[model samples]
Target: MEKNDLISDLLVKDDELAVDYYAFAHPAGFLDKTSVQEVATALRTFIDTKVVGNQPRRNVILVSHSLGGLVCRRAILDYLELGRSAGARIIGLLAMGAPHLGTDIARIASKFLPSHSVPDMQPWDELLQNLNRAWLQRVVNDGDPDLGLEQRGSVKCQVVFGLKDRVVPTASATAGAYLGELKAINKGHIELPKAESLHDVTYDVVKQFIRQCIEGTRTAPVRRAANVLADRARHLVLQDADSALEWTRYEEDVVTLGPLPAPEWLRCEVNSTRTGGLPSADFTICLALDGHFPDGVRIDYRFHFGRGLLTEPEYAAFGERLKNSELAPQDLDRVFGLKHLYLGVGEAPELRIHYEPHDRKYGAGFALLTYRIQPERLLGVGRTNTLHVCLWSIISRNHGWYSYRATRLVLEKLTLQLIAPFPALELGSSIWWCEPERNEDKIDNDRYSSRLEIEGPIPPGILVQWILDTESAGLSR
Candidate 1:
């Protein structure tokens, strides 16, 4: 499966939720783009609405991932500088795979993808070094006597990271975490925010933290300190600083509670399916349903690449790039990968864009196509919401692929259709829901050829392996 998607929806499954959660969306613009301090201002503005006299009426926890952790930390730091405690409302920050010290991925990605965001996350960048230094003193070290967190506004922080994370190193991700607040798992960076199920380690840790934060035990820190050494015990953890979470910038003309979507978004993956004779993206996704809106949904499906979304001029530029680069016609994905899915979607909610290859320990050459559908638009009449989409891409090959891991959501119905070039071999697939069928003789070599279909109730681990024999069928691999 893919780890690029956000898991904020999973938070809704908690029955004993202590605070109302919000998945903050960043502001849209080049000027207000992925800068750390700017996004922090927007974050502070948003927090203002939820608080009275600069302190929240209820307990708050900030859940952040990657660069978003940085944005949240900067917001808190800005408030501490101004003698206004944003942490009074924000009692706890749950940082998942955040880079407190800059990441090396940003250093390398900066070469092909030259964006200000890259430098912000580099380990040796000045801004990053300063942010960490200030944080260690004022936040972690509790340097200011007048700014007492324990007496007036107490804030707690916890960090969770994987030993195997390829994006942000474990050392950088957990630099500010204390022994009491730190958790180390074996999963990768992308898998840090997720759990195997509600009963797994991820959810268990979150539930315990929620209980502790809501309790507001004043003497908890004293107890933690009693069992301590020099660089040792403390009940609190530190927050994140870079990338996906930005300290959004707001120009004087438009300053409000809303954080706009940035000019360019980090790339995401689309299900490999063929649509409208394009190849049916030969892909299928299984998500759970509860009410009018999808209660818990896990979407990892693909549709064969069609054409739309991109502006005509933008499309032409890519076509020209393909010709001039002297790359094979099938290598158009490489050209799109160079651009980093520049959405440029200023203040608009809809995300319609191109494809890019994933980095940071992902499979090489597997170009990712990203899109977003509004919740109102995605939900349907009853519990089951089936929306047909056309994912436009320049690639032609349609290999067999599927994702088994579905978090938070339950899968009740399953309908899978696999279509490929002729002389295909359907190796092995074991799943049953309603019905199953096969046709070995279905063919048309001229247009686009070969096909397979399956319908079933998905079990825990169902594997399907097949071969289309593209070389013998005169189809591109």
Candidate 2:
């Protein structure tokens, strides 16, 4: 939080585009010693809270030079872990003479740089090696062999290195950068980030990259991705909900399209396998969500619980687990055999969220989970998005309730599914929906599901209820 000295020295003069810029700096050995990981952690926090806060439509492009590029990479890897998005809305990385590979100058010119930072940039430096290894696996290769670096849909990376630079080697600065994508300049390492004017080659390079980033956000794969997701959302139903959400594995898009927004008619499947705590259920309740974002998201999917049925100790225990670095987000947890399925991953690769356990505040046990629809150019054109949500509850056979809050978004279709064995479900309510245009069927031979293709916006505060008479209400095997 010290004066971000970088911005103090930076002069952004883009007349054609409306863009926002943010920069930060940390204390190094000059004033106070620091490490790249520390800087990266700070940068990650800044990104989540300031740069990308709550704005789904926003996009970010990281522009860094020299050692700062390593800071950016380390910070990125901090957030873009097993199950997180690009730390924030970061759509691209623009590195000017960054050292993904360690620099030869570390030993050759050690006294010229800070004691703490220069050593960390030495060839075969542990931090640089670790950073490069993960970057190669997660950012560069990332299993999508068909897509190019920029087209991967996670973060479009563009690299620029100085041919006349003497500080950081071209090989180090351009490490992990695609060979064909490298932009060579006659500037030095110091000159690459400092443009004399809009006429400077440095300015031209930066300008071109920014323009392409802006244009890319508005066209091509983005527009195509939106169209694809919108068209396929109806088919992207949450059909299979195990302890974790699962789906048939296969490559789909010609472009990875990464994580964009949820599409229209967002198909949601809520399955109640049992009314007990099990590997797939809460101790005494469970409702599983099998849904899709259509294209894909890195991690942006999120939902919360409000002290649901958790005693003070249990609530504290859960919060503790959340803080327990090893059990951080995307690290799955199992309680009574139930798998943590939010932001679902793995072979199934479906967006299956088994929502909250029980909350009486909603007048029903099921919480009304409101999920943000990131309008990340993947939800097609001509559509406005807002809070999207659904809920499922198993209460006394005498009554069950669900609620919806009207928002800027329209309800295209809502699908509700119930999973149970023959005996218990046979005694459950058969015709529950009041909506005339409803369809029902059996799934996996043991589950029952219903669908409603709504025509217009849903009324605000619409509370749905069902009452059924059962001989015995216990869940059947």
Candidate 3:
């Protein structure tokens, strides 16, 4: 908004990779009186003069901060609609602290300033909704020619936000509802595009995103993995082949009570196969804990189901099962139809079955059982739970891979948190997604060590692999 030379200050010279930067200047009054379309028109004029046909057919990366990001998006959409070649050249959009989704802060400002753009930034504003809907449709279609963008070319969209931003909250800045791979930095809204040095985390992430955009490798690995899983799940449920099932259980505990002592152990293994025209993967998890609680503890088994995974019919059946009084039997075996589990047309999408020992004798506090789930169901595609695991330890491992599929669905969001006894770790951990080149480095900490959040429409079923090393803390096996 001020006379800051953001582009010149941020885009330092790179010896290995040559890049040309351009900054668009507009009248200050435009911010208060002009509409988004008008601002976009001004931006389009600048691009036409400076970028279009000015260089060798190179792709262009639009890096915008704050309100400028919104203007850029509008201009891009306008170009796509007009069938302009400039639209095809847009490789990626790295929006920093831009309220792709309207921010409530604008609601307060609108009462004072009679600015047209300010109203457009209000939560659920009509203009914001229209833009978001169009953008989402384009993304869902993967930039299909039918959507106005070239079929062969794709635009990578990434949003970076400030965790402590007061003007724009994380949700608005990231635009989580419409965009995926939302990244958060430790800077404020004003400092987002003004990193002091290359060592700044925000600067590093922005640099990587720009490089990925230029190289045409903007899709995140997490999204690729999600797509694979979704496709497998669809095939398993839609085809006539019999479903394959695999079970795994890993646990570790410490019970230093009175007399009885239990051994501690850790085991991990993986087995894969193709059965009845469908692929099957299996994992083995083994953990042992030796400890006791004076007040007796309740091992809460919580299962989380991704949104939109259940069809209306399946949801109705699950509701009925919960209402059935006879189904309240405490016997886990009978409850799950003798196998301690069941999957069919009508069943709970997510199950939370608690296990409490009758007496504290301290001999394998929890049973060493193999919990099997069909690959399709475990990696849920449609209306089913795709992932299943026991929540017991401070450290856990999620290891598996899925084959690529054309019709793979998107994984909307993933959030993970660690319980006590485990100190909070910065977003940096041994988490790897999709390929070795891609790592989980864009992590944000809101003063909590046990919390990790990821925003995605990431492809399902790539490799969601990670290992938690607890050996240093004396947690073995």
> What ordering of candidates by TM-score runs from best to worst?
2, 3, 1
For model 2, how does the per-residue alpha-carbon lDDT over 1-477 read when each residue is reduced to its tens digit?
A: 222222213334455767877777666433335777877788877877888788753577788887778888787666556234344656578888887777886766566655677667788889888887777655663314333333233556778999999887877877747511688889777777775555667767776777787777643333333322333332333212231231111101010001113211111223221111112222222211111221221111212223333345864555555444223222122211233332222232334443543321111222121222223322332222121223222122111112111111223433333232211121111123444354555554433443333333332222221211122223210
Model 1: residue 230 alpha-carbon error in angstroms: 21
Give each model's whole-structure lDDT. Answer: 0.45, 0.45, 0.45
Residues 284-307 of candidate 1 have per-residue lDDT tens digits of: 222111001121222233222212
Question: What's each prediction's TM-score?
Answer: 0.41, 0.45, 0.43
Question: Which candidate has the top score in TM-score?
Answer: 2
Comparing candidate 1 with candidate 3, which one achieves the higher TM-score? 3
Clashing pairs counted in every model? 43, 10, 41
Query: In candidate 2, where is summed lDDT lowest over 10 consecutive residues?
Result: 251-260
| lDDT (10s digit) by residue, model 3, range 169-263 | 78788664455468878878888877655556776777788777766532222333333333333333211111112111111111110111321
Worst lDDT run of 10 residues, candidate 3, spans: 251-260
For all the candidates, what are their Cα RMSDs to the real structure? 27.2, 19.5, 21.0
